[model samples]
Target chain A: MATVEYRNITKRFESFEVMRDLSLSIADGEFAVLLGASGCGKTTLLRMTAGLETVTAGDLLIDGLRVNEVPPRDRDIAMVFQNYALYPTMTVAENIAFSLEIRRVPKAERRRRAEEAAALVGLGEHLARYPRELSGGQRQRVAMARAMVREAKVFLFDEPLSNLDAKLRAQMRFEIRQLHDRLGTTTIYVTHDQIEAMTMADKIVLMRGGTIEQVGTPDELYDRPVSRFAADFIGSPAMNFVEGTVEANGNAPAFVAEGIHLALPVSLTVAPGSPVVCGIRPPDLVLNADGSIEGRLVLAEKTGPDVQLHLSVAGQDFIATASRDAAVEAGGLVRLSVAPDKLHLFDPQSGRRL
Target chain B: MTVHSASRRRLRIVAAWSVVALFVFPLYYWITTAFKNARDIFDQPPSVWAFDPTLKNFEEVFGISLGFLRQQEVLPGGGNFYMAPRLWDSIVVAFGSTVLSVTLATLAAYALSRFPFRGRHAFVAWVLSTRMMPPVAVAIPLFFIYKDVGLLDTYAGVILIHAVMNLPLAVLLMKSFFDDVPKEIDESAIIDGASRWLIFRRVVLPMAKGGIAATAVLCFIFSWTEFVFVLTLTQTGLKTVPVVSSSFVTSTGTAWGNMAALGVAAMVPAFVFILLVQKQLVRGLTLGSLKQ
Candidate 1:
């Protein structure tokens, strides 16, 4: 396993800078995920590490060695492309054994290792099948097997499960985590899906507009996001945001918006009369009889285990999740309270967390 | 409803057959004329079915007069009707040029498909523009060059020119085939520790087999039928079928039967080549329509 470091890396496409002065250090054997929306430079970052794209400025180091000019073959890294990229003409065993064959491994040993890799992916029976003959999930497994058999110092995955169906995507996500756990190979996986990052990453590097917005554990990102974008991106049903002014109410801070006044944590400090955006996760909002905030429920959707409430509060839309057993109705007035600690405060002008 | 649909299907079949027959009519007439005597060929109102078929034309064109058969009277120029060596020359030049052109085009095309060099579009346009020059215009300059190089009537000279003539079309066709292959495959191969050429040979080339076969067939057919360069550059040392067929038009009159005989014989090699690659040709034609 190897640690990958990008020191002040910047990528520009003919003056249109895609990644700007980005620095990240991935620990050896760490499953680091580069997570962001499309055009956020997450894939570009992964491709840089894979040696498919050149770093326009600064240095890229693998295991503390400067590898700026190293070709992909010399980088000792294996990549699983989004399309699975299996050689269409090669059978599953041959595909898995390609790296070994390139190294001029003995035929008997190549076959043995290929079968072992295939069995690791639960594809032992598919050894003789070509990629075109396999289904999407099977082809994905073949690509994984191909990467695994290389036993490289680093593994790069470029949105590898994005093409699979929802059910298959979840299954493969879990399998990938399990594979990483077993191998402990340094991996950098790029994806726009927050759930995959949350469930699989040891550290999630959230990116926006070609720069790092937050790099932390999933819980840290969800609980203490550095920016409003991070707060909005991490949680399902999305975090609710209310534009308001922070005011002093007998030393305890209060967030006041149109037709609403919510108490802030006593220890929280912000300048009085300063505009800020307050964020609260869906599950943290509780419905109580004597809650401080009142809103008219606009829609209620029961998604299996939870009922999602879309409420209109102070002329702004907010979402809150409750148990499936919760009795909520559309067009009904409801009182909601947020736990003070769960509330996130951000500067209104810059969207930076305060 | 059943009767109406069945009749509609029958009508479609008839229309398809009529179209195919329309195309095959000229070839049928040409082949039949190769076996007819001069009297039968110019019969009043034309004899479409009934004719005294003869092998005299073939015997003259092939320089083979069969034993135990009454030999037909030869033309005034007697031995000039013998064209077997010219037929051999056509086969050699076609096969040689096809092999040469396909190899060069495939390599050039793979580079064009993968590499992002400056002015790549302009380079491709320049390569294609070489073909825009009219054959007559190119043949005169080529004749002088061939004479200077002492390649005036050599097989190598003809093959080289034909290969050069076919390069533009071959390269364009092969490049499209390479483009149909996803670039990810090459990247994946690179990450697997294979070099650029290894990835091309083992992965990209195998996938583009159908396209290569199709390109080779087209090159072969074009070389087989080329006329201008062969006529302008060569003497009697070597002659292709298209140029040699003109020799039949002596000072007296055009020897139509002998020319038709040569034309009919020339079609066999090209037809056999197409038949051999017919499966790949169909597949290559529709290659880019489906995503792998």
Candidate 2:
């Protein structure tokens, strides 16, 4: 229900800084996700927004009002922690109503709001049960319900679904997305899982080593990552990077590595002798009988829907994902081709996309 | 059915029983001795069980004189002369000391646990070192100071000494207990619009009930049976149960019967104190460290 802005925010623990000169704005009602690996300051940024942590030097605005000195209780924000943090002693109903009780809402209204939120999280029957009695997924629902009942201006989720098993994580991911759509609250979620960021965020903020790397929509980041780090981090099986030199071949451009050459897209503008790293996503590399690039399959793994093949060209390793029906044997020679536009080129030294 | 397997099972059972007897025998001896008459205590082969049980020992203990006999009574240079029994006096001193010490120590422990302040670690180390010092070493200086302040033979003097003696242990134990509670629970309350004090009252304190109970029990045990300080500082009137029991041994005769009864009375509180906390003691001690 409110926009959040971080202007030149920095956090330090003693002499070591965790977040430095970080500035980003989340529009009102936007599902923005701060994505990064552990200790990359994503959760630190989220906690600062929730007023659970102090910003070393900056302005944190909620609804355009600075909240640097505001305590968490007065910040009018709700946070769902990774561990749920549901009061072990309280029943589901009490947990959900805790905020309302703190705000001194009437008992009847508290009960009504708690029931409504419980129904939203699909925990209507679990109102009387304590957190310990609930399953992991149910405990998570109770945590969600607790946040929902507050109806605060901002919703901060610090890797809320990371604690669940794979199946539960996927299911809760959908539920969270649906809940966001329904509530339309200005939410800032922090997670290290790029897949979660891709599936859930309207805008993703990629961070590395206490600074923002790139911020964009999921498709924008996947289609054109600004750096090698982004390209490598935002995909499953990760993007394959091959170090090579760009060479002009009869008006066409090609990347030349040791004992190997890959023809670049016709639109590539890199001059000859330019040191570059070419990135190819696993799924984009197709396995065809008449494909241009040939390599021996080093390993093949059948993972239900797709079979992943680890192919070696000369001395370099490459991964190719094919349909489950494809019959590929380890150590067998196979040709792999990728769409021209799907290839990403980066400057070797700086790692910036070229 | 196998010989090796049977012997192995027997060995395991014997080991378990040995552990049980190791802890249980001392308590059993104390309980049996509390009931024995004077003759049975010194029988050729000391009786394990009381042949003639009597409450006479208890009666004799309650009736015993506990006043200090002044060495220079009616001195040439005049001074007040007095001989008094201080059983009731010790009870007052111990109770007063335990309450005052534990209350202050608990508050100190809470602050050390919850807040981050300047020199917090150094302060904790300093308090812990105070406990490491032998009670006898501190008793010498404390005795002179209390005497100078006109606190000789006063209940307050003994109580104050006991409180200082027990405070460090109480503080250290409580700090560990408070640390065991997860900080996430506190943050959850904080984000819910509850103030810091409210969080402590409704969330932290309730969760720490078991811990506080455990600390109180430990503090009470230390304060109740402290003997050295009470013996040195208090010459008359203000005597603890341990100090009263010590008086029973003299050159004239050792009143084993009276001593045993008084010893049993002192042990009763310590026993009951542990029993009260025994429910939470196991959980509080482990604090779920064994759980994955």
Candidate 3:
């Protein structure tokens, strides 16, 4: 296992910069995820680490050695691509044994190691099958076996579960995490799905516009997002934002919007009339008859054990989740309450958290 | 519903067979002329049937005197009608040139498919443009070059010219085949600690086997049927079937029977090559349409 470091890395394609001055440090045996939307350059960063794409500016260190000019072969990293990228012409056994073969391991040893890796991925019976003969999830397992056989310094995954069906994707996600836990290899996984990041990442590096917005543990990002983007991006049903001006009512601070008034914490030091965006997560918003804010319920969706309500509060849309037994209906009036400590305040002008 | 569809399919089959028959008529007439004697070949209204078959034309073409064969007067070119050696020459040149061209084209096409260099599109276009020039335009200049290099009338000379003539088409065909292979395989191989050459040989090349076989067949056929370069470059030392067939057109009259005999014999090697790779040829043509 190795630690990965990106120091001021920048990538540009003829002045159109995809990644700009990005830096990150992945600890040894850490499963760090690069999470973002499409075109957010998470895949580019992963590729740069794999030497598939050049860093364009800064140094990339693997195990504390600068690997800026090292080719992928010499870098000693194995990647599982989004398409699985299994060799179509090769059998599953050959595909797993390929890296060992290239390293000049003996034929008997190669076959032994291939079988071991295949069994690790539950593919022992499919050693002779070609990639096209397998289902999408099976192909993904073959890709995992190929990477596992390498026993490389780092394992890179570029949306490895994207092609599988939803149920399969969830199943494979747990399997991948278990494999990572067992192997303890430094892995950098790039994915747009926040659930994958939240569930699998030891450290989630939330990215937007080619730069890291926040890099923290899953709980850290969920409980304390540093910006409005992170707050909205990291949770199910997303975080709710209500725009209002902060007012100092003597020693107490209150947020006043069009038709909502919510009390802020006393320690929040903001100008009396400055505009701020108050963020509250969906689950933190409770329906209470004695609440300070009222909204019209637009819709209610029952998903499993929780019910999600889409509401329009203070001229802004918000989503709040309650228990399945909560009495909620579309087009009904509801009073929502958020604890003062659970409120996240950001500047209305810059979107940075205060 | 089944009956309507079955009748439509039957009508389609009839139309397809009619078109096939229209295309095969010339080859049918030519093969039949190979078995016809000079008298029947010159008969008015061209005997389609009821002509007496003779082995005399085959005997003359192959220089083999079967006990039942009727011998004819030897032609004026000192029995050059013995075309077995010429047939051998055609096979050697066509096979040699196909091997040469396919090897070179595969390497060049792989580079074109993978590496992104400046002017790569223009380079491919230029390679294709080389095929647009008429062979006659190049034949004279190549004749002098071959003469200076002491390569005239040599098998090597003819093979080299034919390989060069087929290179553009071979490269274009091979490039499309290489393009069908995903680039991820190459990157994966590299990450698997394989060198670039190893990836090409062990990964990409094997995946492209069907395509290469298809390309080789096309190159072999083009080299087999090529006329101008072989005619202008070779003399008595060597001649392919296409050029040697011209020698049958003499001062007195054209030996249509002898020419037809040579033409029929030449089709066998090419036909055999195509048959060997017919499965791969069909599959290779329709590749890249489906994701694996």
TM-score of chain A considered alone, across all candidate predictions? 0.99, 0.97, 0.97
Q: Model 2: how far is A149 from its true place, Å?
A: 1.1
- CAPRI grade of model 1: medium
Question: Could you give candidate 1's per-residue lDDT for residues A1-354 as a string of tens digits?
Answer: 999999999999888999999999999999999999999999999888888889999899999999989999999999998988788778889999999999999999999999999999999999998777788888899999999999999999999988889999999999999999999999999999999999999999999999999999999998899999999999898999889899998898998899778888999879889999999898998998788889899999989989999999878898889889887788999998987888899998899999
Give the per-residue lDDT of model 1 (tens digit) for B46-154.
Answer: 8778998887887788777754676655656665355564688999999999999999999999999999999999999999999898889989898989999999999
What shift in Å separates residue A128 of candidate 3 from its native position after superposition?
Answer: 1.6
> In model 2, what is the error at residue B68, expressed in angstroms?
33
Question: Candidate 2, which segments miss by more than 4 Å at Cα?
Answer: B1-11, B64-96, B147-156, B284-292
In candidate 1, which residue ranges exceed 4 Å CA deviation?
B66-73, B76-82, B284-292
lDDT for B75 in candidate 1 is 57
Model 3: how far residue A167 lies from native, Å:
1.1
Residue B93 CA displacement from its true place in model 3, Å? 1.1
lDDT string for model 3 (A1-354, tens) is 899999999999778999989999999999999999999999999999999988889989999999999999999899998888788778899999999998899999999999999999999999999887788888899999999998999999999988778999999999999999999999999999999999999999999999999999999999889999999899988888888899988999998888888898999988889989989999999999999879899999889899998898866888889899998788999998989989999987888898
TM-score on alpha carbons, each prediction: 0.95, 0.91, 0.93
- Order of models, best TM-score first: 1, 3, 2
**Which pairs clash in the backbone of model 1?**
none
- Which residue segments of model 3 deviate by more than 4 Å? B39-46, B66-85, B283-292
